[model samples]
Target chain A: MIIGQIKDGIVLDHITAGKSPEIYQILCLDKLDCTIATIQNAESLKMGRKDIIKIGKVIDINFDVLGYIDPGITVNVIRDGKLAKRERLTLPERVTDIIKCKNPRCISSVEQELRQEFRLADRERKIYRCIYCDSEAKKQI
Target chain B: MRHLIDIQQLSREDISRLIETALDIIENPGRYSEVCRHKKLATLFFEPSTRTRLSFEAAMYELGGDVLGFSESNSSSAAKGESVSDTARTVGCYADIIAMRHPKEGAPLVASRTAGVPVINAGDGGHNHPTQTLADLLTIYREKGSFNNLTIGCCGDLKFGRTVHSLISAMSRYENVKFVLISPEELKVPKYIKTDVLEANNIPYIESTSLEDNIGKLDILYMTRVQRERFFNEADYLRLKDSYVLTPEKLKAAKADLSVMHPLPRVNEISVAVDDDPRACYFKQVLNGKYMRMALILKLLEVAV
Candidate 1:
């Protein structure tokens, strides 16, 4: 399978197998006018199989969402067909407007304008709790 | 700038100071009567609460501070679709401090961020009620003379009981404190509280269904009513509401020196016959709540004695 590289764009590499669709949906990649390609089940030495997403244009990405979804994924910035930056993500201590608090009794449920915020409650377990209700975020990913 | 959003926000030293101040208020009421002559407290209760709202109002009044604000959402601008932040900002302009109780969790936190004055979370859904923990602390301190080396048996609804969670969190900080959590299987304490709080602190605790079985070993028997408002299903509320009632028969197994406590507006979780059991300290807890609130109000206002 031959896929063309982009001159100025982002390559989300080393994503866990079968997780790019969620990343794409959450990041709202469909709204972007630029070309995007998702290469699934690619052979890798580090991980037996991995997913790669290639964005054809340089666009802002929410690293917190990426970190929360899969911290193992690597973000590479391509500028003038050269790897400008290679970045690794870690779980954010706090996240805002990324995930909604599902607790029905949460104040954010009724107040539409309030930013959905979560704090990393446990680092080892990758547990995030709603800032308002303290309800644990469901394991959607 | 300080707000009492969660009991965890308060350190052990802070709780000790608050308890000391509360005790001092109880001992020498006249000395602190006129401490806040010009200050105003706004009780912004977005939900119906008999004890907490009145307790804040009474606390402010006792300190020579005027009290204002609404009893429920209908009477306040919240009924007109005003956000908690807006209501808090508006209320902050009139009052020196705000004590808020809302049905939605973390409403007071939102208010605390926007309300220019300090905010006290009276109650926010089933999330937190720090002042109630203060009252409980004062009662426990007065009864047992210390928070250390005590066996606290929390009975009834441990799941949605914010007071129990707060009390557990507060008391767990002390030395040699143990807990006997008595609740139905469906109403057991949340897993995070057990794992994050109790286990994380190396605090020893046990879960049980029978109150009578564990009542004998307790230094303090904290009873909580299964709050109907917390339930989404009426059938579940009805089934669980009467799970553990503290009758005199059950009290017979309890220690003679056991301090029986409850956060009130209780609905038959405790029998009326047990009210005169001499060890019943629920009424005292109510009075202690006012003193604690007064102390808290003074603390937040930076009022020096």
Candidate 2:
């Protein structure tokens, strides 16, 4: 499988297998005019199989979403066909407008304009709870 | 700038100071009277709460402060599609402090962020009711004289009982405090509370289904009504509502010095006959609630006596 390199873009690598589609949807990649390629279950030395997402343009990405979805994923910034920056993501302490609170009794449910926010309650367990209701955030890929 | 959202927001020293202030208020009421001569408190109850609303109003009045705001959402701007932040911002303009009770969890937190003044969470769904914990703390302090080395048994709906959760979180900070959680299988305390709070703090606690069995060992037995409002299904509410009832027969097994406490407006979880048993401190808890609220109001307003 031959894929062309990008002059100035982002390469999301080392994503957990079978998580690229959800990331694509969350990032709203379909709305972008630039080209985007997603590779699934690619062979890797570190991970047996991993997913990768390549963007043909350097677009603003919500790092919180990526960190929350898969903290182990690596984000590489490509500028002028060279790797400008290689950064690893860790779980964010706080996230806003990324995930909605599922608790029916949460204030965010009725308040449409309210920003959905969550705080990392347990680091080891990767648990995020709604800031308003303290209800655990439902698993979102 | 300070708001009472969760019980955990207060440190052990802070709780101690609040308790001390509450006790002082009880001892010397005349000294603290008129401390807030011209201040105003807004009780913005988006939900129907007869006790908490009145308690805040009474607390403010006792401190020589005027009280304002609505009893329900219909009477307030919230009925006109006003958000909590809007209502809070509007209310904060009129009042020096705001005490809010909303059916949606974390509504007060929203209000606290934009209210511009101190906001006290009266109750927010089944999430948090820190003032009630303060009331319970005062009641416990008055009865036992100390928070340490007490076997506190929390009975009834431990699952949705915000008061029990707050009390446990508050009391767990003290030395040698133990908890005996009594509830039906369906209404047991949440695992996060057990692990994050009790276990994380190295606090020893036991869970039991029988209230009668655990009643004997408790220094303070906090009873909570299985709230019908918390249930989504009527059938589940009916089945679990009668899971535990505190009768005089059950009290016979309890310690002589045991303090029987409830949050109030209970629907037969406790027999009326047990009210005169001298162990019933729920009424005292109600009285203590006002004093605690007064102390809290003063603390938030930065008032000195």
TM-score of each: 0.95, 0.95
| Weakest lDDT window of 10 consecutive positions for candidate 1 chain A | A132-141
Question: After superposition, which runs of candidate 2 have C-alpha atoms over 4 Å from their true positions?
Answer: A1-5, A33-35
What is candidate 2's DockQ?
A: 0.75
- lDDT of candidate 2 at residue B188, scale 0 to 100: 94
True-structure lDDT of candidate 1: 0.92
Instruction: Give the DockQ (2 decimals) of all models.
Output: 0.72, 0.75
Backbone steric clashes in candidate 1, count: 0
Per-residue lDDT for A14-99 in model 1, tens only?
99999999999988999999999999999999999999999999898889989989989899999999999999988989989877
Q: What TM-score against the true chain A does chain A of each candidate get?
A: 0.90, 0.91
How far residue B219's Cα lies from its native spot in candidate 2, in Å, is 1.6
Question: For this target, which candidate reaches the highest DockQ against the unseen true structure?
Answer: 2
lDDT of 1 by residue, B1-305 (tens): 99999999999899889988988998899998899999999999999999999999999989999998889899988888999988999999999999999999999999998899999999999988999999999999999998899999999999999999999999989999999999999999999899889998999999999987899999999999999889999999998889988999989998899999999988899999999999999999999999999999989999999
